[model samples]
Target: MNNFRFLVDPVFSKRFGIAPFIGPKRFRPPALNINDLPDDLDTILISHNHMDHLDYPSVKQLNKRYGERLTWFCGRGTRQWFLDNHVKNVIELDWWEEYHFSKKEVNIAFCPAQHWSRRTAFDTNKSLWGGFAVWDTTHKFYFAGDTGYTHNISIFRQIGKKYGPFNLSAIPIGVYEPRYMMETQHVSPDEAVQIHIDVQSKKSIGIHWGTWALANEYFMEPPEKLSQAVKNNQLHPSSFIVVKHGEIVDLP
Candidate 1:
């Protein structure tokens, strides 16, 4: 299986004149600056329509650079947007459709996430939103886009058991605040740990935190709380890691 490397929390363009920021005040976000990446990038799987995940500017840049050389997989609701933008080579899938690409046996499955979607005021949930499960013949990886704790997690666990024992998972662990309001949309650090256990992944990395200021909590809290939760729950430190921007992990 080819090892996948992710460029975490990158901001390609400033939005609404606000410079994109990562984490609290401590970390620096990475910038690739190029419109095109490697030619071997076969597929780009996006979790949802949120600006961060479905970044239009970045996508446009990539599309212009790579054209049909890259295939995009996104949530069902995002089809029209891509069509409007004239993005070909795009596949929009609902919560459980599987798409395969390449001779390497790479398969992608769209999974459900407990979150609402709206790029504008008139279009909430206009597109289905969710996470993703990617597997090659030998290993599986879960990318938990923005989500809250929900029964669907167990569904993913069942899916994992049926087809997995995933080698790695990228689960969200930030943006939860004022539990009353965020609980239904974002998972807390503790809840993230529970997800790690539910999926029974061999190792899980935390993301989506330390990226944007989407909530009221202090920025540094997510990683700190995640660390404590892992200790309180007795999960191995090596099993869960919080990566910085520009960092790369070679999948085992």
Candidate 2:
């Protein structure tokens, strides 16, 4: 899932002045705005510093409302930003590191992803980038942050061998266009399906598309492409789902 409302100015308005690409206008408003978030929010999981994944205003608002009560978990080299922003109780983990929350009886492990990071030119790859595997007693979930079809896709096999056969997976299936340039950063729909199989997920959901016109494809193209790929591979339709903006799926 992508959330970028609080970053309207920096991401959409190009508050820093446009150099190359600016103003990634969204197709529709977010289903839940920052104010609409639940007060019961206890922990925040940040994948990286990208504006779409980690919004400054949103984090500030959450910290303002929750304070030390909120525990933040993020990738390596990203903790300083939270500290600089006055948010305490931050835990940053390198790939394959795990953290357990006794109170919640859940464990979260940072996993591998073929992706890079950058908020500004000088900060490229200054921080780590990866996905996460979260598990409770009976359920294991994978959140594939943002990835590409790297030759080292064997990383998924490692994930599957360790924490996978995932009960559910949220995989990015969009923002891939002009393959020459994007192939190294984003996964096309076909590649996403491979990730689903690679991770051994019982069910997978397609995300990262239809929210913003981040690539050359139309807003509705990802799901259609995914459907075709699934059919071509003879995979069941229900194996991977494309949910609507405000929809919720009841997991077993």
- State which candidate has the highest lDDT: 2
- Give the whole-model CA lDDT for all candidates, comma-separated: 0.75, 0.78
Off by over 4 Å in 2: 1-22
TM-score, per-candidate, Cα-based: 0.88, 0.89
What is the Cα-based lDDT of residue 38 in candidate 2?
A: 61
Clashing pairs in 1: 23-210, 77-127
Q: What is the per-residue lDDT of model 2 for residues 6-111, given as tens digits with 9 covering 90 to 100? A: 1111122221112324546567666666566666555677777787777666677677877887688889999998899899889899999999876577788989
Candidate 1 residues lying further than 4 Å off, grouped into runs, are 1-11, 16-27, 151-153
Q: What's the lDDT of the predicted structure labeled candidate 2? A: 0.78
Under the 3 Å rule for N, CA and C atoms, how many clashes does model 1 have?
2
